[model samples]
Target: MTTAERATELRRLHAAPELLQVVNVWDVVSATAVAALPGTRALATAGHSIAATFGYPDGEQIPLHLMLDMVGRIVRAVDVPVSADLDAGFGDAGETVRRAIGQGVAGANIEDQLKPLDEAVAAVSAAVAAADAEGVPFALNARTDAFVRGRDRSLDTNIADAIERGRAFLDAGATSVFVPGMFGEDVVARLVDGIGDRKVTLIGLPGVPAPARLQELGVARLSYGPTTQRVALGALQDLATSLYDGGVLPEGIRPLN
Candidate 1:
């Protein structure tokens, strides 16, 4: 599909009755491996995983060019749509999203990082404007750090803050509002009710409700962040331990790449 077509497909996926489950990939190999799955319809890049691959920390620490370069390679490697985690937009949300569109990214996640409400809304608008200029539907997952960064505050306060920011973001042209921290069913329900059904995205952390349950709760999308990469590394570590313990390479290992 063309870049614009892919972006439109991503938006449609988000609006589908079945929740969109995007497996986070960091590079071409990982992207292709996941995209090869029968159920995979789209991909989301984990900025943290990409940064770690280059020995840098997350939060836009990886140089913008390097991040975009890797994301571009992943885009070229897979036929499915890709939604990149362009964390905090690398200090220039508009320009970063424009370049990501140029790389053929169908969507992106831009975190507010608890910035002032007005500034955060502006960032969302800027990103949307850039995508509009590029003529792509660009699923901009505007993220609010209220829950993640407001740990010291009361749950009610954080939820309220998230709902407020989420509404503002949606009004400013975000495709969905990503609330990243873990929460119970009640909290999720409140968010869905407050933010509008099927307009909230979530992360799939350990112990979170199953995707089916989350879909029932009206979530639009669910993405595994750096956990996917961490899980792969954990398997590698287990293999190394077995090898050191006199075990031969396991049989039936398929070359995904």
Candidate 2:
């Protein structure tokens, strides 16, 4: 399928009856590994994982050019649709979103963590316009940091604010409303109910409800944001530790081919 076709498919997955489980990847190897899975419908990049793999910090600390290069490689390596966590659209929302579309990404997670509400809405609006110009139905997952940044405030306020931001983003043409740092079923359900029309996405945080439960709560999408990468890195650390402690590698560790 063409890039635009895949983009449309990705958008459909978000609104499908079943939950869209997205396993985030960092490089070509990881992308290929996940794409090899029989049930994998799409691929997504974890911003922190991509940054740390290149020895940089997350939160847009990685250079835009370098990030785009890596994402381009991943998109080329897989036939499945690829989405990237383009943190804050890498400074220029419209231009960077266009760059991602050029790389053939089906979707992206654009965060509004540090920017004001109006600016964030404008950014998402710009991304949708850019995608239209490119003739791709880019799945713009507009992420709100209300729950993460509003810990000091009351829970009710955080949930309310998230719904408000999500409504604004959806009105601005976002494909979905991504509310990270929200794990509770009640809050998740509330957000889903409040953010009408568009699909709702939640981060796959540890100890959160199972996929079935999340689906019951009306979450259309769930993504492991950096958790999979951190776990993989931990495994690498363990392998190195075992090698240092003993001369032999683990019994199950062997070449795939």
Candidate 3:
């Protein structure tokens, strides 16, 4: 599909009745491996994973060009739509997303990083406006770090902040508001009710509710962030340990790439 069509398809997936589950991938091999799965509908790039793969720390430490280069390669490697994690937009949300659209990325996650409400909303608007200028129905998963960044604050405060930021982001034209962090069913329900049904996205962490329960609670999407990459690396580490202990290669390993 063309980039625009992919963008539209991504939006449709978010609005679909079934909750969208996007496996986060960092490079061409990982992206292709996940995309080959029968149930995979789309892919979301994990900025932290990509940064770690490139020997850099997270939080836009990796050069924007390098991240986009990898993201573009992944886009070319798979037919499914890709939603890149363009961390905090690398300082210029609008231009960053504009460049990503040029890379054929259909969607992206831009974190507010707990910036001031007005500033965060402006960033969301800028990203959406940039996508509009490019004529792509880009899915902007506007993220608020209220829960992640506001750990010292009370849960009530964080939830209120998230709902406020989420509504503002939606008004500014974001496709969905990503509230990353673990939460109980009650918290999830409150967020969905406050932010509008099927308008909230979440990260699927170890203790998070199951996808079925999240779907029943009205989450639009669930994405596994750096955990997926960490799991893959953990397997490699175990294999290395086994090899050192004189273990032979495992049988029936299929070539995915």
RMSD of each: 0.7, 1.5, 0.6
Reference-based lDDT, residue 145, model 2: 90
TM-score list, all predictions: 0.99, 0.96, 0.99
Model 2, C-alpha of 218: deviation from truth (Å): 1.1
The candidates, ranked best first by TM-score, are: 3, 1, 2
- What is candidate 1's lDDT per residue for 1-257, written digit by digit as tens? 99999999999999889999999999989999999999999999999999999999988888999999999999999999999999998888999999999999999999999999999999999999999999999999999999999999999999999999999999999999999998888899999999988999999986668999999999999999999999999999999999999999989999885
lDDT of 2 by residue, 78-162 (tens): 9999989999888788899899999898999999984688898999999999999999999999999998888898988988999
Clashes of 1: 0
Measured with C-alpha atoms, the lDDT of residue 112 in candidate 2 is 91
Query: Which stretches of model 3 miss by more than 4 angstroms?
Result: none
Q: What residue runs in model 2 are displaced by over 4 Å at the alpha carbon?
A: 254-257
Clashing pairs in 3: none
| Candidate 3: residue 43 Cα off by (Å) | 0.4
In order of listing, the candidates' clash counts read: 0, 0, 0
